[model samples]
Target: MGRKAIYTRVYNQLRYEILSGEIAIGSPLPPERKLAEQLGVSRNTIVRAYSELEAEGFIVSRMGSGRYVEALHPAPSHAQTHWGKQASGKLAAAPSHMAELLSVTDTYPNTINFAHGDGGKHTLESSCFSDYVKSTAEQLHSYYFTSVQGLPELRERLVAWMDMEPISSPEQVVITSGSQEGLYLITSLLARPGDLVVTEMPTYFGSLQLFQSLGVQIIPVPMDANGMRIDVLEGILARYRPRFLYTVPTYHNPTGWTMSLDRRKKLLALSERYQLPIVEDDAYRHLHLDAEPPPSLKSMDRTGNVIYLNTFSKLLFPGLRVGWVAANRSFARLLTRMKELSITTNTLGQLALAAYLRDDALRPHLQEVRKQYAEQAAIMAGHLDRFRPLGIRYERPAGGFYFWVSLPEEINPRQLMTECLQQGVSFTCGDMFLLREAEQPYIRLCFTHERTDQIDRGMKIIDHVLQSRKELLS
Candidate 1:
């Protein structure tokens, strides 16, 4: 056989052994002359094979010692494939802080988990959700396929209740599996790789992760209580041409700060001037504890720039993964096509929610939920006085599931999280929501998921941990 063929054969064998774990990492490979003699090949063939392995990062050569296995694998040669080397990076990059963020930190004792946005728990008080599901299921039409836009009945129902005035026609809506899919569709389609997009700093981590996975650059604008700083956004728009701007305007996630009406007007003005499209995620809009939130961007928009995304899951059913996008006729049609390409439709969820809405059951049920959440928010807030003494400051959220609390820089948020978890308590650390994970002096607390008593218990535990952390400092 040719010398090239002999070296190539040796290279393949070594590569297989390293990848299969037979050649353990850090173990020394046989010396070149020894390996050549054992395999009945020339020393030059062994040298060539070892060079191949070293270049691929499967092994490393150390002077005076010998070549040792450095890695079983190297960076993917095919970024397109989705297996061993084929798959995992795109999905794996999502929510890297899931253990600390999602409250699945493997604590043995019963944990008061505050990591997830449990819209599911809030709906336990719901009365007629099951009835509508049963009724809708009994009908054969509910089982049949609907339009790419969604069921006409469902779209019509959404139009009637949508806070936005732009949704005057069913043709202007596209039903998605959930608002999350709406985000994915919008971001993936509008912003290609290497393109820039704008987002609020400490915004939804899901969007941050999605953008990073897609190789999209995020221009994070810091927000105040009034919402996305229009002044900063104005500068960003002037400087960099982003594909779109994403905001959770009403009763925002992580931090329950709503955008003021004045800021909303200014934002729309900017959008009009620059012709930038806005993707407004209004998931928590219906959870207002007191007066209704200011008019949504879509509602205030005169120009067809705002693409409104909302979900029914948070309303009265968490498992009900039905959501819709309200946009201009042109954008709506494009989103409909995107939906068709991604997820066809959630027919059963749409049918059930539509039937429930048709009966006008949502309004009363929402009021009850608002009251329940308000009470829960208060219960959690009542404990804040205890936390304030420990360098922990938090604003009592008027609506939404979270209280974006600020901890002291002196204290590490992850350490606090670790101590809390050891004591059967769990909450999201602040850094999880940032574009870059660091020791951020903020933590997000959810009050709507647990019962009032559980919420109270969790707070006491957190307070105790904070006190301990503070005492240690002194």
Candidate 2:
């Protein structure tokens, strides 16, 4: 077996032995060399597995003696039927990696975090926001539910702010809880269970989870440096008809590669020819570091086939939970009607965000994030220079929060992440963004959520882990 396979197998077997009471509590485990020889693996592999067990509190090492198993008081087993057999298929379709994703972004107790998907988390919090939120709520003397279509004033403000002429208007907008809700609404409207939809291979994992939960089968189209390969898309289109095509396009999530203008235009031409509906998720459009990207796919469409979704989360903050969909008035109206299935959108958030935009806060905020995030990205790039010699590959993004790196074949991605976590750094593995797991390792590091100081610490720990793993393989 390979190192990863052998290590995992040995670790799991030892754990099972302990849990099954075969390896009694407080008993001394076999020495490293003995275990390695018995398992037909290298001593380093045995050491790695034992180190994990020690870190997880399954065993402990004595001063000069050897490792011994610790007492693990098992929880009392309850006699009741398991829930899986009775659960719906959609619930079963929900993937397990989401729990891992949450550990990095939400639950993990890490010293430095680079796995958070959202940016502006640190920069956007303030007493000023608190005051604005309070004032907005105070101005609403009576408790009235926001419309299903969202607060009218917010919709009007969004139309003016977007500045997409001719095609966009207040009536063409449907306010949503977040861009995520917009994705759900679009999927519900256009696609059904067992339906196929086209997406970039390494697209946003969040979207992949949602689609799978809704019983949608994804047909992933591979991407290149310039973004999704149009030629492959054409072949897919010729073979099977997907309900819609979803893309991040500008400063795409996970990969951070923007679609070239030429490809964007070609994609539009193909969309018109195939009559394909495209979902333009413009979450990071305003977060560029250098030059501005080309116009959004929605702005170029005259056929009204593109459903454009935008969020204030990336620009302002995620907790604000305000986003919108811009489509033709007819489609927008349908979305608004469908939204009645859920409760009215958060009115306080809508009113507060509209007021913030009314004060013209967006322009200055954009400029500020552009500068702050650019510096953060540069700091990470400088630190990542150490890995280039180790066959790590990445291109610093022009904009967006993540750095997508393809790691050397010598390293095991899951093992690397676990060891790095033990050293107090966290980042998302690349397989999380795909429809399936990957053989060669890839990872997405988000820089905008952490400051320059934390970036230095996180990258240094990652560098150390990479070097150690490389040596072990050697």
Candidate 3:
């Protein structure tokens, strides 16, 4: 073979090994001279390959310790494909903290798991839901499968409920098992491997997992109290040209920060400027305890650039697993074909939910749920106010079910979680939210699941744990 062909072969093999996790992150690669000798190539060829890898941020060279693999890149926040399991190569293992959170199984033994984002089961109490289920069961015998894009009635009702502009037609909506599935389908249809995607730093863990799985390169844009820092986003778009922008604009998860009207306008403008699509996840928008929910990003989208996704899980029941997407008619047709090949989301569930939404009972039940969540949020805030330790800070969420608390820098949240679990109070460690291997001294506590007394008691236990570990903080 020619010298160039020989060099190319050696380079491709090494690249494959690095990406497949054969070399592993932070591990020293074989010496360049040794690698060349093994591959029957010149040392110059190996050197050229290593240099290329370093420039691409796949690996780094240390002055004396030799070359080691760099950390894996962050995935997009909106799409499930970006967040799916990594497929070999020099990819770092899923962050240890996220793995620990997912593996936590002692739900009833000792730990009071406030870590999960789900509202307490009490929110499921409603006679209307039972009524709807019965109505759906009666129709099941006569039910033929609905159109691939889902029941036209449900799509029409969803758009009206959100107060979104007229969708052109029912063909523009695709029902899926949940909003997560909708996100996965959208990304699969829109993005290719190596596409750049933008998302908020410390965004939803599931979204991060999906994007990582798809091998999409993620650019983390920092979010502030108002929402995503539009200034930073503009700079990123001009420089990186991401394929899409993913956001949870109203009552954002984890942080519970909503974007302002002005910022929302700027976001849409930025998308138009860059010709990038926006994937808006509005899962928690309907769970507002406050009087007026902010107008959604979808409501504001005018140029057909935004794809909106929402679920009935938080507002009604998660077990139903019913969610839908509002997109351009052409894209929706493509996604429906994808959904048909996958499982047609439970017909019974969709029919039941359609009945529930169509009835007058849903509004009154929602009022009751809103009252309950408001009370729970108040109870949590009151407890935190009375017993919170020095140096701890938290945002008072206006609508959603979570309280995002930031702790002292000296404390390790992972260790604190262990200590709290020992005390029979459980919450998520903040490190799980991060894309990189950095430590964050924060925890997400879900107030909607527990009674007021339970919230008070849990706070007391957490306070004691922190007091006992105060020495560790220093």
Candidate 4:
């Protein structure tokens, strides 16, 4: 065989091993001469093959050490062939932090996890969810693909479920795998690289991750008690012509500050005046612990400017991976086409969700969840309030799972996280949510997952940590 053919053969074998997990990531490859001898090829052939793997991002070479498989796999090379550069970029830039957050730390006995967003002990019945999938598969019996816009009945059900002022039509609703996919679709289609996208300060980190991957510039507008400051947003609008504004107005993540109705209206007016599109992410709107949240921006929108994204992930179950985007008829149609091209929605799951929604099962379930979360939130707030005199501050969120807490300026947030983990407690670092590094110390805790008793214990652990730090300083 030709020398080129020999190297190609060796390269393909190495690539297959890496992709198939036979060659674990970060494991060193055999030395060039050793590998060449084993494969009955020249050292030059091994060198060329290694270079090929490195170029494609499957492996890397260290200065003194041998070649090692990359820890993070590159996007499938076939993505550009099938979809385009956008698809490739999306897959390649999948956030590393998400993987860290999703790891199976559950195996660690006695570890109190507050890092994840999902229902901790309150997660839905797996057997029932399996039944939904099985029943739908057996009964529905459609060998063909479902509509890209989503199963028709599901779209209709979602529109009725949300019950916005303007009343969305079935045609205006496009189903997505989840809110993450919806955000990705919007970001990919609406704005290109170098375009500006404005977001609230300390906005959803997931959104920030997507924006950064897309090469879109994110301008953060500071938030207050009401929500994203309209005055600050106006200043940004005047100076920079951003392509769109993204906000989690109701039951804001991390901080849990719901936007006041007045601010919502002002935001709508600003969007109208600026002719800027608003991507309103109301993922946690239904998880309201106390009163209902203010009218959604999409509901308040007179023009076809607000693209509303909602998910059942936080409320019902995230594993089902079902969500929807509501927009004007034309844009929604465009999104449907995009969905069709980007790995069509899960047919069986959508049908099951539709059946669940149609039977009016979600409301009763939400009522129970609301009560539980409310109790948990109060317990968490009470503990923090006890530590209030120590300069630790937080807003008692009206509704939502997270408590965004600020520690005393003297304590380092990273150091505090390490200490908390050592004490068998884990929480999200607040800087993960921000577009830039923040000056003061902040952290996010999800109270929804832990049992109230466990939460109390965890809070006491945290309090002890704070008190110890204070003592050291004195």
Candidate 5:
């Protein structure tokens, strides 16, 4: 073959190896002379191939060492070839934008973090948690691995805990790392490429990522103050016959709009009629500020229609990484096996959390959390009320960490996010929750993550920056 043909063959082979995950990321390629000898090609041909690969961004040449795969993509533009892109059409375009908000927090140590959904400064007391750790450690004599379904005691405790939510027995529960894992496991079992999954328009971003990763087609159902629009959902249900309905019925993440009793019943009724199961992610159920929200769909479900997902991450600490999925006995067993095949649940944390729950500490702690977040939410609302004329629209969240605020159409959310970060405050842009093409004149700010003092300062900064932008647009 000609020298050009030899180099082209070499380049194609190397590119295929890198993209197909055969060579592996960060692993060094053989020396040019060694590779030339191995491939039965001239060293110059191998050098030409390496140079092209480096230029294309498929590999990088280190000064002292050999060439290594920098990324699987040929270029930043070629990154659209991610497994998610091939499997699912719509990708969460917000991670890049959201990273900017996260970066501000990392870069500016004192930057009030309004973007993250985490327990604030006054999180669980160290002494209280230490006590549980001490007690749980004492009880756990062996350091060996436990069941993938999680610690028996933890599952039993969860069963009792779930009784209030009216979820089924311990037999129906399969413990997972977090509700995130539960979502993944269930999605793996049910959804496949080209399958349809329905969700609220401004649903949890994590759920969207999971669905997109599986190559499932996501059909968003619009929501109002009563939560997901059942009227709109009925039309989609009649036409599409989705795989499952994913929703956060109580104190939703971004909007904090709880599904009303009427809507909840209708949603369940539709699920029953269509034989569609519901994945009820009740992550923020305990964070209600004012009054109790409506009963969860799981609680109301008469048939084995709702797969209930609950997590300790929101109310409790995130590091614990304990969550559970409650379904019918048959599905519960399947989930338990799925957990076994994939990864085991956190044993130490589960034991510790079980010990903590045994004392019924969560209720009292939840009361404190409710009071603190309520105060913080009210403080933020008061400040935001002053800036209402700037076209900042929101329904004051009765509970949960976030206030989903809608900006004026003229004001670009990305521009506002950039200016806010510059002024020592940060929030997630609306585009983070939806596709880039979707018109998202919105932003989500977390009140629970910041202290009362920080909320005031942060809101003032946001107010000043946004008011200036509004005036410019005017």
Candidate 6:
């Protein structure tokens, strides 16, 4: 065959081997001359084929050393059907109630969605993320699959970025598709059917979804302004012997409460007493408005009981879908294997994130986000305070982008949500975050996505609805 045909043949062969995991991650490919001799093709054909593979993110080259099979390939066991029956039985059921609530889109015509946690600033020029993307494109030729635990260099840099001492080794960290995936992996590995999983009442809706999917019995404990009620948690732990207690101790999702330092200590004490693992979800930990963020539970754990899950979706951009888990080495290994069975995350995205983390641009960008979110949150809170009727109550959040508003007993938030949607304002009903069917006339309003004018307009419409209802009552 001609050189062109030969090149195509060699390229496809390498591609299949890489995808099938016959060539392991980080393994070196034969030199161009050696490969040419083995295939009985010219060195130029081998070089061309290798070049094509490299360009498509299938391989990486070291300056002096030969090209290596990029770690971008899927793990060897993904194609195996051995786990299919188990997975089918486990995941066949529909998602939990909270999951269904999260899936509901707020894209009604003319409606303003204050429901999402994302920033509303969509202009490419306004986002510092554009810089990360530009930098990633520049290094596209060299990008490759990161280690299962993620790139060591990126983890090391993350250590510095998070203001913590470096981990002893990279093997203790497992890079996940997102914090959601990290939670799922941890729950699947540590929890069994009928095992009790503890969490704050009205905790992150996504965590409830994960635990439900794994068939774990949820034990919801109540929380006050200081965060999860440690006294109540102690009593529950003594009774239930839960496998793990999941929490967002800082800037909690729906309540927007931060745990006090004393409560944090008490939580660690409870962990020690019960020997229950703490799955600390720090998804919003970085979006602090007032001061430097609190030390992560993983960082504070001396007995190795805390499994920390963090993500880039809040601090950086949501679309990246990159996060990591810091846990004991044993658990990390199981998570890595589990990830192999699941669909591998986007290799290109991981590489770009690694580059972004390494570029030292995150700190200033985060500072800008914190400032903007703080301003926007304050604006929304002011409008709510001024417009909301006497029966409504809300606590100003210390950090993060959400405000949980508790409405009057007379007003049904579910019905109000529907009416508000008609008025072009959208927010999540509070029942969406609860585990049981307990009713609370509340809703979560996110101030991050809308402009000041939009927030003002939305609140005015909601007030109009409330006033109109009051007039009918009179």
TM-score winner: 2
Candidate 1: what lDDT? 0.78
The reply for model 1, stretches above 4 Å from the true place, is 1-94, 97-109, 120-122
Q: Put down candidate 5 lDDT per residue, 160-204, tens digits, no spaces.
A: 887744454677888888888999999989877668788886777
Tens-place lDDT per residue, model 2, 1-474, is 577998887886776455333454456898999988988889998999899888766789998999987643211123435674444544425555656666664555655888776664567753246656888878763257878898888889988888887455688999988898999999999998778788876788878888877878676676777988787788668767889999999998889999999999999998999999999999999999999989999888888889999987788777777889999888899899888998777888888878878888778878877888999999999977778998899989999899999899778777888888878888888768765454446888999988788899889999988988888888
Clashing pairs in 2: none
Question: How large is the C-alpha RMSD of every model relative to the true structure?
Answer: 14.4, 12.9, 10.8, 15.2, 15.2, 23.5
Regions of candidate 6 where Cα sits further than 4 Å from its true position: 1-89, 92-110, 122-125, 138-144
Model 3: per-residue Cα lDDT over 162-247, one tens digit each: 66673656667788888888888988887766777778766777777777767766666667779887887776666666778788
Question: Candidate 6's residue-wise lDDT over 1-474, tens digit each?
Answer: 577777877876776555433454456899989989999999999889888888876789899987876533111122327758667555524235544444445246557777777766642236566766666667754355556666666667666665544246666788788898898888888889767777777777777666665667666666788888887677656656778889999899888898888888889988988898998888888788898656777777888888888998777666678888878888888888998876566666666666667776676777777787888888888877875554788988988879989887667788888898877788887867764333466789988877777888888888888777766666
Comparing 5 with 6 on lDDT, the higher-scoring candidate is: 5
1 versus 4: better TM-score goes to: 1
Off by over 4 Å in 3: 1-110, 142-144, 166-168, 471-474
In angstroms, the error of model 3 at 154 is 1.8
Which scores higher on lDDT, 3 or 5? 5
lDDT values of the candidates? 0.78, 0.80, 0.74, 0.79, 0.78, 0.74
Better of 1 and 4 by lDDT: 4
Q: What's the count of clashing pairs in each model shown?
A: 5, 0, 19, 0, 0, 0
TM-score of each: 0.80, 0.81, 0.79, 0.78, 0.78, 0.77
Q: In lDDT terms, which candidate is top?
A: 2
Q: Assess candidate 5 and give its TM-score to the true structure.
A: 0.78
> Which sections of candidate 4 miss by over 4 Å?
1-95, 104-110, 126-131, 140-144, 165-167
What does the lDDT read for residue 53 in candidate 5?
A: 79
